[model samples]
Target: MKTIIKAPPRRKPQSAGATTNRPGNPATGKRLPYGLADCVIFLAIAIPLLIAMCATGRPGA
Candidate 1:
């Protein structure tokens, strides 16, 4: 006598509208307020360069 084995059923592919099972929106809130910190950091790096350029005179001179 031969034995017959059946495979388990497969799950359906998730639909585009199936967000309920997904995690909360990645951009739910102001996750990265990029203004103040970015400006401060940019200025922190830029102001020194600007002062150095002014103190050293024109470039390639």
Candidate 2:
């Protein structure tokens, strides 16, 4: 029989000089810049695949 071990949940440490209620920190609130960059990168890869799929639809046109 094997025993299962569970890890403890991680907690975020509060900044010394920063306010915990501020909107800049991603761990505490929304991160627009990072989210936008991620979306752009995803679209960059997806667009090429979409174009390739469309181009191949004409049976080697």
Q: Which residue window of length 10 is worst by lDDT in model 2?
A: 17-26
Any idea how many clashes model 2 has?
A: 0
Q: lDDT values of the candidates? A: 0.83, 0.82
Give me the runs in candidate 2 sitting further than 4 Å from their true place.
1-34, 59-61
RMSD of 1: 9.3
Which candidate has the highest lDDT of all?
Answer: 1
Model 2, 1-61: lDDT tens per residue?
9999989988898788775555665577545567878899999999999999998798757
- Tens digit per residue, CA lDDT, model 1, 1-61: 8999999999899888984754477666546658788989999999999999899897677
Candidate 1 segments exceeding 4 Å error:
1-33, 58-61
**Per-model RMSD to reference:** 9.3, 9.5
